[model samples]
Every structure is written in structure tokens, then in C-alpha cells.
Target: MRVPGSPRWAYGTFAWLVFFVVSHVVAVFFPGEDPTGDGPWDLRAYVIFNLVLILMSAVGAAVVVATVRPWGRRVPRWVLLTPLWLGSALLVVRGVPGMVENLLMATGIRRGGFVGAQDISTAELWAGLGINTYFFLGAVLLAMTTVSYVRRSRRDAHG
Candidate 1:
């Protein structure tokens, strides 16, 4: 039996990984105005948050590379599966609720409060939009790639 391959998923995951890394780096260098509109932005907290984001993205990229590369075949299966499972769970937990809330707010069905509604400037609003859009897309892409990786791996093992 021939093991199935998903080159497109591999490449797309890599592309999103690049976007994730680059965007986080840019945010670190040029932190945007606060969207909370409550108090002075905490630079230390923001940097720490982005640092965590950068580390997570790095780990995600490594998982993607390991899933797609030949040498990855030699790595312990659990090592790759652990992060992939955790990432998928995180994406689903966050993204599903987020997309639901966004739809509800957009439809004006439930609008007591919404995330990122305190933008005081157009730039802030646009930045929030970009970040949200990137996150949603990345979550979806990551989920898809995770599925593809699992399927291909299973095929390789059983075939």
C-alpha cells in the first residue's frame, strides 16, 4: 500500500507559520496602541504575552516541519502527536466560540459586549481586525493540516 501525501497542506501550514512568526516579530518591534481604552498599556505585560505567542508559534512550526519532512518519520510518533493534538484542541476551543460570538455580534442578536470594541482610532481598529482575521484563518488552516497529517501518518503506518 502506498502512503498518501499532502504536499499542499504541508506548504500551506509552513506559509501560515511564517505569517505567524513575522507578525509576532513586527508586533514586538512596533507595539500598537492599546485597544482596551481603560488605562495606560503595560509594555512589560505586552512583551511577555508576545514572547509566549512567539514561542508557541515556533513550536507549532516545528510540529508542522516534523510532520511533513522525511527525517520526521524517524521521530517518536507521540512527540509529534502530542503538540498536534494540543494545538487542535486549543484552536477548536478558542476558534469555535470566537467565530460564534463574532457571528452573533455581527447579526446583532447578542450585543451587550464584544471583544476589541474599544478602539479609539482607525489604526487600532484595523490592527485588531487584522489580528483577528489572521488568528481565525490560522486556526482553521492548522486544524486542516493537523487532520491531513494524522491521516497520512496512519496510512504510512498501516500500509
Candidate 2:
């Protein structure tokens, strides 16, 4: 709440992004646990295509974090902020509705999910809720980190 961009928040965001990416990498390496509960998502075919995307996302997140750190001031601001904003937007746009729908289904305030005629199970509902919530949290952390970097840059320039 104390202005999203702070030293502590920056560090936290980096940590979260690292954890998220590393976990996803692990999933790619060992796709034996699909959070979606679809079972087949854990298979080799489904996982092979995800590695590239995950690595690319990891690079972007690292860039954002690096730009916020002291060592990254020399890096072009736009280079980092562009992807940061886009990633944050993407996460929020995907997360909010997914979270809401999953929450609604979990609470029994709604019925099945958008996934065709498949009836949503309790475990799957909870899993979806957690995953979506993670996305929302990631969006917040990334946005805050960007704010911190921009604020620091502006403050340094003004002085």
C-alpha cells in the first residue's frame, strides 16, 4: 500500500517471479502433475511446447527485476517497461475472470466451468482458483516493481 514501488516489494516480486518460473520449468521437465487436473496435460506432448514459452516469460521477468535493481539503471527503461506492462496486463486480464469463475464454482455460487460439458470437480475447482489467484498476484508484483523502477529513475534524475 505504501506506494507499490519499494525496496522490499521489489525483492519480493523478484522472488515470486523466480519461484513461478522455476516451478513452471519443473512442470515442463516433469509434467506429472497437472494443476488443471486434466491428467493429459502432464504428458510429454503437452509439455514439450510449453518450455519455450516458459523460458521466454522467465527472461522477461528477469529483465523487469533487473531494471528495478541498482545494477540495471544503465539499461534502457523502455526495453524493460514495455514487456513488464504487457505481461502485467496479460496476467490481470487472464487472472481476474478465471479467478472469479473458479471462486464462484468453488463456492457453489455457480455451476460448471467454461470447459465444455465437463462437470467441475471440487479438487479441480480449488486448483483453478489457486492458479488464477497466483496469476493475479504476479500481475500485482510486476506492476509494483515497474512503478518502483520508474519512481526511482525519476527521483534520481530530478536530483
Candidate 3:
């Protein structure tokens, strides 16, 4: 809902990313039931994979925070823009379609035929839908933060 920096968008983005990092970290260490039991990925592999995700998320949070501070001007334009655009695009691409598919299934417009769709209980589908919503939301927040960054950068450049 917030589009401007007046609401302190960068700080908020940083905080949400921190929450994401914390949640993923907990999920990695504690683990959870994977009903599908999809692959041969053992705990070690799972931990490593999740750690990589955690690291990426952490870096994103750091970028938002670092670039908002007074010292941010020293950071190159590419350093700020690259991850902001790339991460937002990636999240939108990953999230939006999955959400549509899930919505279709939920409405019974489509059924029984999508990746990981078969044999999934309604509860699981709803859970997945919720997570996809989070992804889409994260993309939006990141994009907003990017806008904030660009505006600040432009103002600074003009001055």
C-alpha cells in the first residue's frame, strides 16, 4: 500500500526480510514434515540448500538497510539496482503463476493436473496458496523499496 519513502519503506522492507530470514533459519534447523517426501535430499542437503536461501535473503535485507543509510551514496548504482530488480522479477515469476494455478484449483475451474497438484489435500493447497501470497507480497515490497532507492538516488544526483 505504501509507495513513498515517507512511510520509511526501506526500513520496513529490511524488517520483513529479517523476518523471512529468521523463519527460514528456524525451518532449516527444526525441519518439518514433507508429506510428499519428494526426493533423496537428506538433512545435510536440506540444511545446505536452505542456508543458501537464508544467505540470499540476508544479503537483500542488508542491501536495503545499507543503501538507506547516509553512507549509501558511496555504493555503486549497480550494486543497489541489480539485486533489487533481479530479486523482484524472480519472485514475481515464481509466485504469480503458482498463485493462478492454485486459484484455479481452488475454484474447481481446473483440477487434478499440475505440478505437485495431484493427491494434494485441500489443506495443503491452501497452505501453498498462502505461501505464494507471501512471495508475491515480498516482490511488491521489494519493488517499492527499489522505487524509494531510485528516488533518493535521483534527488541526490540532481543536487
Top model number, lDDT = 3
Query: Worst ten-residue run, lDDT, model 2?
Result: 33-42
Model 2 regions lying over 4 Å from their true place = 1-4, 33-45, 116-118
The C-alpha lDDT values of all candidates are 0.72, 0.71, 0.77
Q: Can you write out model 2's per-residue Cα lDDT over 55-85, one digit (the tens) per residue?
A: 7677776786676567777777787778777
How high is each candidate's TM-score? Answer: 0.77, 0.78, 0.83
- Cα displacement (angstroms), candidate 2, residue 50, comes to 1.8
RMSD values for the candidates in order, in angstroms, are 4.2, 3.4, 2.8
Cα-based lDDT at residue 22, candidate 2: 85
List clashing residue pairs in candidate 2: none
Model 2's alpha-carbon lDDT is: 0.71
**TM-score pick, better of 1 and 2:** 2
Candidate 3 weakest ten by summed lDDT: 109-118
Candidate 1 C-alpha lDDT tens digits along 1-159: 332457466677778878878888888888777622455657777778888988987888888888888999998877988887787778777666666655654455554215534423656544544555566776777777777788888888998
Clashes of 3: 0
